[model samples]
Target: MEYIDLYLIHWPMTVKPGKYEFPFPKDEIEPFDMKSVWEAMEECLRLGLTKAIGVSNFSSKKLHALLSTAQIPPSVNQVEVNPLWQQRKLRELCVAKGIQICAWSPLGARGALWGSDGVMECAVLMEIAEAKGKTLAQICLRWVYEQGDVVLVKSFNEKRMMENLDILGWELSDEDNHKISQIPQCKGYQGLDFVSPSGLTNPSWSFGMVRFDSIIVERERLQRTVGLIEPIVDSAVIPSGIVISSIYLKYKKMGRIPEVLLISAAPDSKPMPMIGFGTATYPFGPSEAARSAVVRAVAAGYRHFDTAAVYGSETSLGEAVADAVESGLVGSRDELFITSKLWCSDAHSDRVIPALRKTLQNLQMEYIDLYLIHWPIIRNFALDREIPPAVNQVEVNPLWQQKKLREFCVEKGIKICAYSPLGAKGTVWGNDRVMECEVLKEIAQAKGKTLAQICLRWVHEQGDCVLVKSYNDQRMKENLEIFDWELSEEDKYKINQIPQQRSVPAEDFISDVGPFKSLMELWDGEI
Candidate 1:
């Protein structure tokens, strides 16, 4: 071949140059020099021998070591992933680093000499397959697919290959995922076939072996000496996003669930919850904060999450979903709605798909429920493209009703989504007008509602989906209480009379040399 698309170091350790065989002599087994080997892989990419370079069977600890010194990081990490042996910790690291996970033994290598039928014989998987009218293998593949990992199944039979491909277009329910999570986890391959006794005991000899079972006790004893729990089994079973406290659950029970918007134009469109948790934090908080906040939101019964590439919260959102699924906070990521945007930097038609793929990677999800153009302008392309715009997300509140934009979207069969319903007070792009308005305060006081709730309920009453951001736990639950209430005619009249002024006027893009010269052009005079 002229060039290979992907080249990966199959295993971390280097054997003697003579013959390719397993269980080599102890002397022939040498420590895998990660830095030098990754550098060589980088050279392969530079010379066009391979389009991308990556690693296989790398542990989280080993990956951190390699990532520390490598000039070019691995693009993918091929590992063993099945419901029976879910590699949650390693997958978490891979997701965070933007490394694609290529599953090697998705079905536990069912028919191979070295493989087991554990995944195929999994009772939970068998039950799920039967209920879904699918084969056990299909259930396994679909589960891996749901995790947003690339499946590398080794199937030969034409009929079975067709069955494998049929795994798409259906999903495993939350109960199925929860049952699968409770299954006993055991590593199929313990690296015993490759490692010698000396390598097992010697600290420096087996840095390349990524399996947790073979090195956990020694590594933990040598590293920090914490014995609170079986680290591997504990982390593997409980998802990374699982909530330890009952605070979220308590708040969730207290809040009313938001109504959902059915977007018929979307592919396999799930109902987009009218009220969503906004992930863009002013002052740009840490990813941990985002992750924790999302978990809390999920616990508080918030289903829709609005994020963007520019927001830098996609990774945390993805992590939180994974944690929630694993922890049974939710049945699946499918239960929630995720909406992201096409940033202006990638607004062009050619870059749109790539930008979306990057967003999926950042979110650690296979598909986004709704994807929208973040801003009005595209670098070199018109806003009118082949893909029908399904939703128009804009700032909508008592202060800025956006009636013109809402009317236009209705005419075009597009859903109208409101953001900053409380005027995004305290943010640089927002104003205090909506929250501080006497008209809104009066309505809220009369109705025994919070000022923020009055604004959200008004937007909801207008039949617009609203996005509200609050990392605080109490406020997070309070945002969902709007669906149970309604605005009276007096309240509606007062809100309608409130002075209208757009809070976030795309001022950054309104420059002399840019596509938009004024707020009117930026918003097409809808402002």
Candidate 2:
């Protein structure tokens, strides 16, 4: 009885009719019999192997049959949970039977077997975690515990296991709990659906319907593009001409040193641009074109470089940075700013440091000048391109969530750079809204600036260095011209008035394939 907080019957006796294996046979053993499993569980309890015994992944039919023949009825039932796959019926059945329900996979598991949707990126969870100075995962786990059940979280990593245990002491507000419960449920598992006699079933799981076919098309396009670039370069590289040297020249003419070019605005570093290698470019990774562009940027006298751990091109970028320094293109690392973002998969405090260290090692640098959160939301989904509801919509980190990280970086004097300054072009406020937002347009009109200029200026005005990307030299120059004009108080106010909106809904894309949840989680507190 001492070995287990609860004993578990691992799965139902049979998988979908024709399937011989049970519960992921590639990893778990097959030829399982529920009757024998239940009897063994009973013996374990009688032999003091556990204080309680439970059945895991069991259906109502199986549990009913088991109870009909058992000398000692099961004391608990465990099932997958998280907003997607809420397992409501199983939970209710256990409740009615006085059998405790132990929730498993509270945070959703990695890879695609779990559905992909950004449900976990709930605004409520982010908000609460932000207020409490806790992680969204902690808040989520606590929510599960508050539901009056034993929560089982599995993490082979020592740090994660400890972090899981650390959740016992916190309490969630009723309002927060209510908000969590209200999170729209989305279906994540489709393997079972295929097993049904229906042969074909509509994947109507929530978080909005995903056109997996469309995503596949887009992903294929991206993969093709990546493949085209992969053979030409060894790592992620930024093209030189792509950077706005004209803007640097213009700023010099204005008697402004333009020491930093902030990428975007985030909660902590609000109203200030973040620090970085002057005006950044996007689609960071290995490419001859990108390398040529970076070389040109270096030749043209640009000195800063930015990349992230997950970009898979830091080595190339690092090589460029080092070459620039060695050739006296930049006097020293201090003279050249290098920035990278921590991936969301490494957002946990324990994981954060190691990830950063690995990134640094890969870049062949002692430390980075700036590190940022790629996005503010965490996508809860599997890492597959074919799956629907591809991202688990989870708010792994809320706005104002990087305070600790910010302080840490600042303490180390590492400047923070924020990406997706205007909430991502594809995300909140699409190109149309960005171009037509009454306030922004008015500001642009008043300042005689283009929409992109106004957007970049808004980020620049925030104080930290700002980074804006454009493959076209003219557009890059335009994005950098932001320093030439300042937003008026009214203009600033108007820009601020635009309601918060995310253009990239997690459901539309696959999750867990990249690091960090929405771009926000990657930023260390510097925002």
Estimate every model's Cα lDDT from 0 to 1. 0.71, 0.50
* Ten-residue region with minimum lDDT total, candidate 1: 220-229
Task: Find the candidate with the highest lDDT and give its number.
Answer: 1
Q: Which lDDT tens digits does candidate 1 get at residues 406-494? A: 66555555667888898889898898888789988888888899999998888876767889989898898688777545788888887
lDDT of 2 at 235: 27
lDDT of 1: 0.71
How would you encode candidate 2's per-residue C-alpha lDDT over 62-172 as one tens digit per residue?
Answer: 567677778898887877667534555556667878888777777765444543434456555677889999877788788787778788777678877787788777688
lDDT of 2: 0.50
Candidate 2 Cα misplacement greater than 4 A, ranges: 1-284, 298-303, 344-354, 371-417, 426-432, 436-438, 504-527
Alpha-carbon error at 498 in model 1, in Å?
Answer: 1.0
After TM-score superposition, the amount by which residue 426's alpha carbon in candidate 1 deviates from its true location, in angstroms, is: 1.3
TM-score, every prediction: 0.51, 0.37
